[model samples]
Target: MQDSSRFDNVISRPPASGDIVPISAHPAEATSAVLHRQIRHDFPTIARGEGSYLVLDDGRRILDASGGAAVACIGHGDGRVADAAMEQMRSVAYCATIFYTNTACEELCRYLVDSTGGHMARAYIVCSGSEAMEAAMKLARQYYLEKAQPEPRRTRFIARNQSYHGITLGALAVGGHKTRRQLFEPLMPQNVTRVSPCFAYRGKTAHETDAAYVARLAAELDAEFQRVGPDTVCAFVAEPVVGAALGSVPSVPGYFKAVQAVCRKYGALLILDEVMCGMGRTGTVHAWQQEGVAPDIQTIGKCLGGGYQPIAGVLASHEIIDAFSKGTGAFIHGHTYQGHPVACAAALAVQRIVAEEDLLANVRTLAPILSGLLKQRLGDHPNVGDIRGRGFFWGIEFVQDKTTAQPFPAADHVAMEIAELGVAAADYAVAVYPGSGTVDGVSGDHVIISPPYNASRAEIHTIVDRVARLVEDYFAAKNAGGPVDAKL
Candidate 1:
């Protein structure tokens, strides 16, 4: 029988006809049966985490290149964050927000609102980005009802194509990811209309200038609003820097300004979904900052708590809060654990660490270096079509034909294959976040390499080197007609 321990139980070798092995003999099978993301695959058991590496049960340390969906802003095993959570637990770990509010929750909310320089007057803490998005959508609906004019017809939302908000039904309704929503389409709300995203790579024409492309996209959004009836729209939802949906794709200059203008012209709120790209991931505290416009209602997560605890939030502008105060005197939404004390404490510590340590400065200092390294190493590679991102959040879009920008078929599963190979390979020893359907919602492939904001120059170089080598070797092996190890 093949040694399951050797491969970290990532994959089991097929047995010979004459050989028989019990299912229980597999290392993963022997371990606790946690319902993992994939039921068929034997995933590696992560034993521990330190710095920016995840140590598996087999003692192999995989460098976390993507921060587990871009969450670990301060890296792993942060003592201060842990201590904060512990302290909060000792005081009052759980509190029903409706009955009473705790100090941790209040403080965290204040910190978040203050971080936005009062642009966001209130914060509604939630458990995950999906929940935050759901709250944002619901709040927008409520906001309209609270208005003096009370346009009850404003029940629709306008989002961009190929964009991701979150996974909840309301969020999924607003999101434009075709694959995620395909299975749950019937259950989703039919109140969203999508326009073309500001994806310059695939959406921009060869002869078009950046300004012209932005104008074109703006026009598309305007047309969609017209098609759906502009006054019927409550908010225009988008991610300032498109995250996993389009591989860290950022909009062109003046794109957000144009979109915001359209939203303002129609009296619709601009909702920025910054769950992945916000909280200093893009060198700014808010991803929308660089876009020259602020979101009327913004959802933030992932790096907000830096994965220390399950936490996310929606930030509302003063206008929205004033409307609620004057009309309803309260938001109608409530979650049992809306402001869980422990989660708030951990997030507070994480955000404090981000501010005190001046990690945003580090991100700004290292952004150009990381970008330069990626371009220097993989720019000329045939399969590497585009390298785009800001700050510590970078993505490399892979192409089947670089000249024509033709993507590999969806069946290829190129991004996931690269990610699996990267983690399993001994030499590369890195973990990257990969996603598909970059083109439209079913074709292109890309991998994100967003290391922690605290990663040093040496760590950044290591990440770049390993990622470059992994991509190069994987494609080289395929071109040579050798069997590619990764099946999925």
Candidate 2:
């Protein structure tokens, strides 16, 4: 008999029930002592890695595809590589580059420079990919300064959309990934222009010829250069193969040649970021080799040390180094860990194994087999719209329909769902690098599967089989009206 209005005024009403509450102090989401060690992962805890399998702390042996984002080129826990690392660590963990030099660092530098086909005169080592990219940007900027272009010959950077350089300001400025830059837009550098990426699946018109597509893209670059004013442009930066931003998308033939010509015409340095696709992951020692052009500056990471140590580096052409030499006798961009001894040692061991074992041959041999298997199994998959990639690295782009080529809605989380199913039901611990906005900057989904270079035939087959099953099952569940796992 009480008034209905009074009863409806309850504090825990429906609308208020789900509202967020403000608390002055609270426990952190990441708890436990191990949380301090690494706050990123929840410890799916891999107990061990043998060959290409990761034995999780839960006793599941998951096939390690994508080699931890193409970092583990060689198989995990390789004793020979381990022994090399231990040897160097015991001999000398570090040496200050400013005052003295170490054998490990000097030898590694010489090896990389020599391996660079007489192009890279010098190599500088750093801790990770982001650091390498930062160094590349600073180096490129300093090169222009050293050349005495006092009026600031370069003010704009031309990079393609759906590209990822790194996380730091200078590198991030040229990076075109929307999701990653959304939060940091305020602090990013100005005058960096985003051009169209050489992505054919979404970008290529149905009736357009490959040659026409390349021309169109080249024209777009020219237009962007004009918009920014040719002399005002500093560098043309890109990943030889689009990595996290576009899921291993390679450019069409004549694409880079055209782009390179344009960059040269504009006096902009061409920076190729091979952080995820270089160092034999793409079956070639250098991804740019297939492109028929050489970059003025190149950045490499991840597989450089094969995850043996956190190491990355930049390779500079003699021209850029010469400019610096003639002017200041230095590049004027130096990092404390610019050439860490231990990192160089670890990368040397990894590189030696790749060369001695003839692993590039392995990469070439298995690439076709993996691609064939992916096509044979999931090529016709309803949910799998496109199967595209090269070398041992591949990506399965999911879509609503293959005929229409319409992507699954982003809210469906199709890529994430497929990733989870692949992990749980397939028992394959695949590294999932997903890309959104493939259609534009916001409307597509895909997953990358880059197996280690040393992965065996059986491991490769298992990866394909498991991932195929996962993709099939994901669609089955989604159509069945069951809740799809949203963790891709």
Candidate 3:
């Protein structure tokens, strides 16, 4: 056996001046070689995870309320998924797609396609949501080319404002998150145009009905198509429930149907990027299932592998697949780790667990409780602007004036402060997903509370209690001229 005493010394050793600090402490100087997301911030080192709680090196257990960006659906450290990945690795770990296909990949793909209930005809697995989106864009373009009457002029794409697809160039080009795309604006494709997002809280007028709002949005899309020449459009992309960019903002009722109708009218394909909100995050396996419409191509990730492995996929409709099969008989795009065996195995295991345990049912059951508790606790708070989401995915938006719905300035970083405070308080150490640019991509703040699908009722209560306390305390401190930073 390995020498266990060797680790005892390291574990018992006192911290040096430059050693990494706990979640609540801030190191004066940078000590690590790795380039973290924020160079100035000191992050806690997680020792291990158990279900809804993440234990730090300092022995404090934090509640993973956001599931690390809503990715951990089955929760952390699921042994069944680990075993499945190990088995796949032992059998055949890395087989190039050009040479051979592994059973794990095939099985995962088949399972995904079947879950779609015939809406999505085929699945093309990739390593991340960005890659899947890139693939979807390429395939959408290729599908138009493979048509009986090729419309070479159909090269333009239309997406929404305050939307995030992915990080890669192609995905970024099609995305509308202004802060993310600001520096890379010159590099983004000029063919892509943007429309207003389907955010009811901000987009809808006081007197506008849902039907009228949908009609107005649809008309705007139609007008954009006309402005750019209808024959030149390739696709219209959106997310059923906006994630990160607008804080889990679900579209108004009939919005997707309206947009899909407009896309069909112009012969442009509909591509839904469900990277942050798909794969059973919002009760249904696919977010579009709740809506009355479906996209021609859809990209999903985050919860797909349940954070066990990196995996995402493009789900193509039958109509698009038929065009490809009848013409090129292949998708032209490729990725180095397409349909990786171990990733596929892990995802397959995660998905199987979701199905066998009926976690979607759990999501459906708990969604109302989460929503109700959040509203009951934080609804009357002066800064709490909105509480919106479906299933386990929810966002609490902060505003300076609730009546006016005016968002706090981006400079204040209210969402980040609340998130940091949540992580710092040992009594209520809960991690939430913070987001900015909720209003027009520069000036709003919100935080997402996306618990794991298997989180118990007691866990949900704890999450709400902690998060509500964090929000209340943060704003109260800020209003009273107190230090609101977690490090303070």
> In candidate 1, what are the lDDT values of residues 1-488, reduced to their tens digit?
22221221121223334221212235455554865443333566689889899888889898999998899999999899899999999998789778899999899989889888769899999999999999999999999999877989999999988888887899988988887678799999999989999988888999999999999998998888899898899999999888888999999999999999999999999999999999999999999889889889999999999999999999999999999989978888899999899999999999898889999999999999999999999999999999999999999999989999999887666676677678877878898888777887878889898999999999999999999999998899767867555322
Q: What is the TM-score of each candidate against the true structure?
A: 0.94, 0.90, 0.94
C-alpha lDDT of candidate 2 relative to the true structure: 0.76
Alpha carbon deviation, residue 231, candidate 1 (Å):
1.3
Error of 2 at 107 (Å): 1.9
For model 2, residues 1-488, the per-residue Cα lDDT tens digits are: 01111111000111122211111012233543543222322335579888787787777777778676678889788888788878888998877777888888788889878877888888888887888888888888788888855437676788989788887877777888776677789999887888899989888999999899999999999999998789887788998888766778888888999999999988889999999899888888889888888899999998899888889999999988888888897765667876777778778898998999899999899899999999999888877877888897788888888888898775555554455455554333454455565655556777788888877888788788877766776688788987544232
Worst 10 residues of 2 by lDDT: 1-10
Name the weakest run of 10 consecutive residues (lDDT summed) in model 1. Answer: 3-12
In model 1, the runs with Cα more than 4 Å from the true position are 1-32, 485-488
Clashes of 2: 4
Clash counts for the predictions, in order: 0, 4, 0
Assess the local accuracy of residue 126 in candidate 2 as a C-alpha lDDT between 0 and 100: 87
| lDDT measured at residue 113 in model 2 versus the true structure, 0 to 100 | 81
> What do the candidate models score in CA lDDT, each in turn?
0.86, 0.76, 0.86
Error of 2 at 134 (Å): 1.2
